[model samples]
Target: MTSGCFFHEPIRLPIDLNEQSDTLKGTDLIRVSKFYKDSKDGRFMSFLHDDARTLYDVFRKGAKESNNGPCLGWREGPNKPYQWLNYNEALLRAKNFGSGLISVGLAAGPHTLVGLYSQNCPEWILTEQACYTYSLVVVPLYDTLGPDACAFIINQAEINVVVCEDEKKCNLLLDKAPRCLRKLIVIKDTRPTTNQRAKNRGVEILRFEDVERLGAQRNHVELPPKVTDLCTICYTSGTTGNPKGVMLTHQNVVAAISAVILQLSEYKPTYKDTMISFLPLAHMLERCCENAMYLVGGSVGFYSGDIKKLSDDMKALKPTVMPAVPRLLNRMYDKVQTELQRSCMKRILFNMALRAKEGEIKKSIVRNNSTWDKLVFRKIQESLGGRLRLMLIGSAPLAGNVLTFARCALGCLVVEGYGQTECSAPVTLTIQGDYIPEHVGPPVACCCVKLVDVPEMEYYAINNQGEVCVRGTNVFVGYYKDLEKTAEVIDEQGWHHTGDVGMWLPNGSLKIIDRKKHTFKLSQGEYIVPEKIENIYIRSQYVAQVFVHGESLKSCVVGIVVPDVDVVKCWASENGIPGTLSVLCNNPEVKRLILDDMLAWGKDAGLKSFEQVKDIYLHPDPFSIQNGLLTPTLKAKRPQLRAYFKPQIEDLYQQLD
Candidate 1:
């Protein structure tokens, strides 16, 4: 399908990588698929072709078959969807849903119904997979967006129905029900508000339980969804503005899953794979992984609602694999440190223990030291479901120290990967046996990466810090209904300018430097990478989040830090400091402690003379979505943050000795 004025193509998959690049030399890179037919490996494609048939088909056909069925799609009580449906059960559920639409004789049912989602809630998976079987298009919603934004997407995709999991979300749809949504299904036990606010204009209403009941009653044998029909519409995280819903076909989704799984299989088979579901399934990364779990018959578990409950949930689920962003790993590091600081004796012993562990890792000494793991790290492991063999870190750059410690101390293999929403989430992931530091590993299976200069925008560059461009089947088609914006990213050529600046290492791994938009030239003519600096600041125990800015300023760098309140409170009680965390941040003694920590960390990071942070201020508040300081992906809004802190920054720089 052509994306209006952007490009004209039949949406064919590229078997040859080189030819595909030539075809997309000028178009947006997001439009491509993640996989193509493996001409050399008939067995591989045959495996995928079989998987496309049924959930169990792939598991039976895979090189390694699992004893356990994949997935346990669940909810709390009666009237809810099935509590723990395995792969076969889920497939049956999808068939039931797909056939029910046909049995009901709904119009426009020929076209696939894709769900646009954001939350990690399991319903996203159920609806998505069910729609896939019926040849319906499913679009995932970015729950972080406002009402108007959600309405715009619902209208653009021509979505007829939405299954909202919570009351707040149900109200959001209800508010926009008249102009867009034709049907609204609430997931919770509570009915749509009895108050006038709960009533929506001109939309049919049903509880999510009712819909599942309808599916449960339908025949499970009929199949209508074709591989060629569209499977989903995943909207890109609006780094710029309103998100564009990208159209993905069943082939596209399967291709993405195949690419990632093939790459993963070369390292470890998925027979008994256990993974935690934390990242929202609305994201293509999680969706693709979810599909892989079904295909491989792996076990998947959900995290409890709150992050505080995640540790407890992990202990229960015992996930062997986890796909997450860098921020989660960083937080995990903080959790370890906080536990260590519980007591003076604990702190001393932990330090000495960490040193010993470091010595063992460096020496390549493999010890099945049950005593050490059981006594020290097993509790942490138990908190994560106990069986975590590997943790996948992505979405952003993870601190090298965090990666090292999880491996050494936690006994969990933390592997860092890289990708974007546009590229079905991951292009490169670290293999189990071979991993490289400060690199996003090698491209997965059939994907390819190349660095290129923005000839048009090259006038602003200093070195060979070119944009990290990509070409793969996992690339998206184009922005939905915004040809003008789509054309800007994807040229007539297929190369999608990732906007990220990076270089290829000699060993063929990718090292991301920074986003082109984020790289700024310092007063001393040194190009400063804000992300690099911000990452270093966040590595400090006291700082939760940091933003570095040097725009229209002097040689010295300045930062705004969000102190870890709990850590600060603990430190205050010991030091006999007074008042709340916000008050402590401003207190003379507390400020001195923080500054001392910052200065020491700055030196250790080997900052350039001009790049050292001279003036650092702690914010009473965190940079959250509510405050507009964070993107939907939880990335810092550098511009917004700098503007917000302008007054405080100015006062800090005033020459008042």
Candidate 2:
């Protein structure tokens, strides 16, 4: 490995630090992008292109610039090649669909809301664009939300019509159809069984293609939205209570796209790039990224709806850009690491190659055609489609070791971003060639970021650690029909109080350290941030997912640990213990082994005695969205987790006492 790598030195790349700086403004406590520091009105960019004022305008511009280029694609069947629709074709369908909605009695204005109840697909984008064409606000509905949550959104948003992916979802909506719902549009053919129930409920059922044909017969003119017109009501997946609908205006989303364009100016997206869309379109991160791609006239292909086949879809699409959540990336990292562990020689070669690549990364150089890449990382690169050049990770903080492994193994620009739905996805995004892990890069051009003191949590802005606050055109207007909730997050001075605590690094980047809402006090009045402690314990090889929990009545924290099945099984085999993972979870020896490892990891990570978990319950089942223990974005739902493991938690506390 050394002989092959020694012949070629890593290439040096030019870097402009000024372009990536977040300038502190006149001792104002807020930091804005350097590119907009000299502006007279102190406002960042409002739109990426003069021709694109609204989301509909962005699509129209794409059609004008790349009319014959592939716009949306999806596979017709398993292992089949992806079929595509060019910009011109997609535009026609959107126009027809918008007209169809009007013909079906939906008012064409910002007041009308259309619900999209589907997974990521070409039809989902078509329906969204159609809504944009007629100034209709879109409200996305997904299955992970369950029928009850879906019903709540449908009733709360006053949605009259819902577009479902298939008859199964159509039936799901029908089962809990709200009184406000008047019509159902099924993307697939309407089943005979659905017709009777829909009719009995006094709601009209229409097929997707029939609606298009109906619209084609009477092509209505576009009712484009103004800059301040309501574009969407994105309902956040709350871990605790009923979801709140975050109202985002055309100006808000457009400014967000502009921010992405300016931040990635040096490595701008172009018409030649293609992205495989797998992340939930309901989430702001995926939605914003897709809009940015559309603005640049790039192609977007949907995953086959089954996550198990995502790899097959990636290989088929060979996409150049990927927007992902940390959970997916973590799985990829774990798989590769497991594969390399089979042979000592293979692991040695991979380590040598990773070292060489990391050396280049430290020098701010990223390239996929280096000797080490070709010799050792070629297989990994090809696993995600050999053409990948950029990977955007968000929704959660990625582990430092996993982040470094992704950059070195995938041979691409792995940019970590930090944001929430209130800010329209990206508040801070790492610049190209910045391989440093654990810190999300400086603020984007559209918004200003500042840290405010949180006294109870002991986080202070003066010390460069506190609750993160953002202010700009990209901030959402308010929560729908909930003025009191809106006021709770957005202050009078126009700053949106992000409930996450962050620390500013010396280089101007922001690192998310803890969550403000997840803090709990012990009986002795010591505050414990469970998320922070869990992050440390998750580093243990035996732990898959850990949830640290404490009660005000308890003196110390307790945890529920989901043991890593493979790692635990391997350990049991080496130690001459025998059982399935579910059985071994109850074994005294296995429990002791895992607890000791977690304690060692916590001690090594500088966790204090009070902060460390005093007792733990080994859980064989992993937390997941379907089980209601995790959100759709794969974040642990603390309240739900507590409710789910109430018995185990009580046992742990009793044992500790």
Candidate 3:
């Protein structure tokens, strides 16, 4: 399943589902073809169906298909191995939980919103399914969310019940939750007070076991949602404003799942296949993808909140498939390559293999070398538990070299896709083996994509760039209560204004160029795309993080760069640059070394003259979620970054002047 010629009406890739993927071992990977013909008509995936109207529908259908197969896996603690729940058992528990909600006086309907505030856990999935089965809107809360943000969403969504992960979370909500919130359901035994004591304060506190017990004694009614009924009020972790709740319906979830599944049809996921869940469940990407995995009759393994434990989890699970952000993929690639660099012969051999892959990709036919597979690649693949076949990369764009190295060295199909929290996960994904150099696949099967001409900076099809827009069943309904904000993005035409700058490849894949709002024109009338430049610059070995900025007063861009520790340390050692990582990061010589290399990488990436970095300041600290520099999806917080770097930016511009 590989080719550059994507039809407006998506046809299946070249792979045959009936036969096992021939790609397991090959002489040379023959790329389907590089010659692409463009079509204006938009295509949706082949797997889409009007069948399931709700998440409950997906679960029930999966239960029927998977039968008694294990559906969910979670650990009791950081040190424990994962345990499983069979589909039939899970379905029964959900039915009992639904009945339990009724005993607790929690009515299931469109009017009631249940807030699920917790980390990823089996209990969380049980409660989430219980909500859908009872037709209640489930609002997910990030465990790391600030108190004020938590309070805002709980009140605005009118949460009827709060499902906390543990006692500490329950106590945090006790003081901050809106007075209207009625019940606190704790997954653990610890609570803010004794159940009777908490009830006297007008909030009933009950253990998870109590709800299940009460429901087990009652008969549960099947309450399914209409396709159009609201499902979740998913809050956006906005970098510059309050979180906006994007309302998703049952149809939206189905469409998103079907579209993603269509792209995945070639690689059938049977019950034997396992998936690891590490992304925050509060995030739409993880939630919808997990549901899709369930529908595919595969099991899901949950990771403890600690990221440091992910490698160990992967080793134990040896999952065939995993969903990842760019950070995770990069880490895996870096870790493996860094270890190889420890040996001179290994590094030389790895480079030779990398060069071979680069040549094969250029020719569109990669010759498979059993020697390379058995020698250089075998150990790395085994580290991931051997059976791994797919790593679905999304959330943000990854460097093309990173994508290539991942596929070649990591021994997995690295499928890069384009999407946002609002799109329910994937708007477009790379066809199984059709890895377009640097492009996200054509618009997904359920989505119709087009570029709306942006004339303000003279950006139009003539220039090969425009604002990317998507319309489909998978698109969200709207912002929960803010129609004004809603109308601004979703037009009367039903197209979602993605606010992303993109251009289509000859083969119809979409190449994201810049963000609509991040484009700033200098006095010279040239547009500067911060993310576009930043992406190119970050590929430099010397750079770890960067925030590029250009003002109307400036003619070129200035950046705040966080140098890579290992790379900088080696450079310091070789060039007689002094000081430890913290000290050297601020050293003038080290800054100059990084700035020069960044410019070189930027130029190599085809950045325009105006987009090149003319001035840069090396920041000692890397931007992180804790400092408000990244969104949960790991995108740069542009507004926050600019504000934090304002003074330094001004000084850089003055120097340029």
Candidate 4:
């Protein structure tokens, strides 16, 4: 039978069930989208909007549907009100800017790559749309990628013209002076010396306004891309070695957009819906979500370059949809918990309301219930602008308790998804009403998922636990200029062998349990998945961040933990132990307390003795992108962390021995 949003309903089951059977048995190993169950190969055949073939078509369709609606918005500065551009106005500018590219000696074609070096801003989207008009592929560069990496991408892509946010970014690029680069277009004013430096480096510097004016004078026609044309080359932020350029085509991105539209069809998005963009636009998660918003004629506002001011931006925008990563959500979760602990009565009342709402959640009903919402959760909801209805979480695993808390407190459909750059950012997503944690729903509409055995890790398809492999229109064509690496990931049958290990739940949802590449065999011949262990340890109230490490020669694992500063401070104050965080990190008593709590948590979760951490070292400072210990996506860079904490890790092992 069909349900709400016909596209979301599974038309046919992969496996047949016997009516008399007690247990639900899904015999089929491969999982395909319900919408395409009748198809021979179950490949994605159409987009939600049939006319929307390329990214440019998506914007044009939105402009036609919501011509006078606000399309893009940006703040003048911190605490400033957002300024906007209507859909028609933005489209005109995009065309003008695209024509400007041609006027400034950039040839329009699929082969031409245009570098976009900027934070999330209206200018960035404009440049992206502008490139779409000329069929030019966009290559994004971010701050986390140092000058050398940026220059490497520039040379590899053979980019001739780059549209930078300001003079500082232009200078950073010019400092590298890559041979393939010829022109630098600064969005803001460029100094005389900056222009002179570019000239000396055998490149021309031009103002963004000059290019737009030139385009206006020329009035060149739009050269829209075909469905098969290359859209963008998103470079993955590698934890080790150089980044790989993932090549996504027009069809790939459009299919991804279709999957989102199909999944959220019940919500019926319109121009009134707004999203505040803060995540780096260079990532596929933000890029794909923003495109989906545009397809629905919705508005988007850019956060101020400063992440510290994101809360202020949220207040101003009052966004209906939020795209988030677990790192940010975890911080929010910590803040609310810490605040609740300040008062006994407040904590009791909050728990009472949370328990009541959680009861309703178990019934598959998610809403801002009148009584609890108005009395207890209203302030919490208002903290995120009071208009949030949906939050899409990806990049990393979110604790189940935090997921439950966010749904109860925020009164939004907090969905957790699993994806990577190779699949246009969403392989699976939790259904709108499913409150289950750990599993990332079923395969998205554009893709079918299957599992392959990893004998080395003892995972097998027969047990429904193996490496997750995806085949779909959403998958990228190949990594740019790296056929050998491409062949390593994509098999002969076109399945992209995602390095992630997954288990198929009874309800058909996929649970990501381990990483194929990140496993290490301990001395006792037992394998350890450090990420899985770390996730368990991080659930401790006193633990903020953790890195679990095990060596081949070691019998047990050790950890480096960064404690929750506020919680730790509160504990210290109550215990009459006075010291700064740095000093307290070295306090043996504090260390012992944290370790005991984490071990207790591990035991409750049924961890084996060898799986539990044998010893731990408390760190005052959190692993951050600035320190090169975490990726831009906030995932720990294991190799970097190991190198940085080598001495501490050795000490932990020595103590354990």
lDDT (Cα atoms) of all candidates against the true structure? 0.62, 0.86, 0.75, 0.85
Cα TM-score per model: 0.83, 0.95, 0.88, 0.93
Which candidate ranks first by TM-score, i.e. highest?
2
Model 4 bad stretches (over 4 Å): 1-27, 37-41
**Preferred candidate (TM-score higher): 1 or 4:** 4
lDDT tens string, model 1, 234-319? 77656457777776555556666676666554333365776778778877777767667766667677665667667666666656
Rank candidates, lDDT, best first: 2, 4, 3, 1
Error of 3 at 281 (Å): 1.5
* All-Cα superposition RMSD per candidate: 8.5, 3.1, 6.6, 4.1
- Report the number of the highest-lDDT candidate: 2
What tens digits encode model 2's per-residue C-alpha lDDT throughout 1-657? 111222233323223543455455456456777655542245777887888989999987877767569999999878799999999899899899999999999999999999999899999999999999999999998878888899999999999999888888988998889999999898888768788889999888898999989999999988999999999999997887888899999889989888877766656567878999999898889999899889888999999989998888999999988998888888888787888879999899989998998998887666677888899888878778788877888989998989998888877778888998999888888877677788998888888888999999999999999999998889999999999999999999999999999998877778899988999899999999998899899988899999999989989998999999989999999999999999999999999999999999999999999998888899999999888899765789998999999999998877777
Model 1 residue runs over 4 Å out of place are: 1-70, 73-83, 100-122, 192-200, 212-228, 266-269, 342-371, 454-465, 573-576, 653-657
Weakest 10 consecutive residues of candidate 1 by summed lDDT: 1-10
Task: Give the least accurate 10-residue stretch of model 4, judged by summed lDDT.
Answer: 16-25
Task: Give the per-residue lDDT of model 4 (tens digit) for 277-312.
Answer: 998899999999899888878899998878777888
* Candidate 3 structure quality by residue, lDDT tens digits, 1-657: 211122122234544322211111132111111111111133333234345547877887777767678898977775577889999898888878877887788787877888998888888899888888888888998755667778889989877688888877877777676877889888888734556555666888877888988899886776877778888888987766778998988778777877767656665455667888988889888887788877767789887668988877777777887888888778878777678768999889888877765554443343233457666777766666666766788888787777887776665556777887677767777766664457887666566666778887566865557888777778898998899989999999888999987876655567887777777888898877788788788877788899888888778888999888888898788988778888996688888888888889877878888888788988878898778788765678888898999999889888888
